[model samples]
Target: MIRIIAVLMLLIPGLISAYGIKLMRDTLFNDFHPIFFHIGIQFFAGFLFFLGGVAFIGGFIVYRDKKKKKQREDN
Candidate 1:
């Protein structure tokens, strides 16, 4: 259950990107700079990636601590 949730969490950004790309393709733009849009999207994606990395690291640390505590209790 946790593993499945973790996998879904990792895929979230890709799903968001796909949706954003579809929207961009369907919209008609006359004056907007494409580079600016690309940069903005990249920034948002980078932020999400950073957050996901933090969550992954935090989860690993918590899991490690729990396993260590269990081992100590067993001994």
Candidate 2:
């Protein structure tokens, strides 16, 4: 269950980041006023990426460690 949640968390951010990148690209091409808003969006996207990445990595580490421990015990 935790692993499934972790995968979902990772995937959600990745999908959002892809769309956000495309939006940023369009923003760059278009004449959008208030560049500050774009900057804020970029920061938010980056934050989401960071958060999702950390959670996925941490969950994988924990899962792998547990699996290895279980194997060791069976030996």
Residues 47-70, model 2: lDDT tens digits: 665666556666766777787874
Q: What is the lDDT of candidate 2?
A: 0.61
Candidate 1 lDDT tens digits, 1-75:
998976776566556555455444434343334554665564555455556555665666577678787534443
Name the lDDT of candidate 1: 0.56
lDDT of each: 0.56, 0.61
Clashes of 2: 0
Per-prediction TM-score: 0.42, 0.42
Candidate 2 runs further than 4 Å off: 1-37, 70-75
